[model samples]
Target: MYGVDACPNTEEPPDLPALGTLLVDTSRNNRVGEFRGGAGCYWSLRPMGGGTEWEVEPRHVRLALPIEQLRARTARANARSRGDIL
Candidate 1:
């Protein structure tokens, strides 16, 4: 009979950032995005300028630096001003 202990995962899961926290995806040219949630083994990120979300491995993600965060916020604001995003 199959049981929970039959196929236990040995590796610890990656720690997830708080929702809405800014993060940088190194695998995606250091794109800055907000942490939306996790999708199985990957994490979902939403662009700061408000676009479709993308998923990335947790190992490839890191907390956005202060400057990066500022830039993302500014870009979002600009997009909003131009009516590119609501």
Candidate 2:
């Protein structure tokens, strides 16, 4: 039997962001979204104004910058005001 250290597939998975945490999907043109959850090796993210969710590889995600977070929140608020989202 191969030891844990000798196993080729023993590499640790990337740490997951907390649910509802804002993140930027770099692979998706830096689209900002809220962390929904993960399955297999993909993470689910919902748009800020609340729309369809998309899956992305963890390697392509990163914490949203402060400005990006503010922008997303502002856009969501605007959508709410416009009754685009509940």
Task: For candidate 1, write residues 1-86 as lDDT tens digits.
Answer: 54743423336658888999999999999999999998667789999999999998888889999999999999999999999963
Please give the CA lDDT of all the candidate structures.
0.88, 0.88
TM-scores, in order shown?
Answer: 0.84, 0.84
Reference-based lDDT, residue 60, model 2 = 80
What residue pairs clash in candidate 1, if any at all? Answer: none
Q: Which stretches of candidate 1 lie over 4 Å from their true place?
A: 1-10
RMSD of candidates 1 onward, in order: 4.6, 5.5
Q: Which residue window of length 10 is worst by lDDT in model 2?
A: 2-11
Expressed as tens digits, the lDDT of each residue in 6-32 for candidate 2 is: 523345668988999999999999999
Model 2: what TM-score?
A: 0.84
Report the lDDT of model 2 for residue 80: 92
Could you tell me which 10 consecutive residues in candidate 1 have the lowest summed lDDT? 1-10
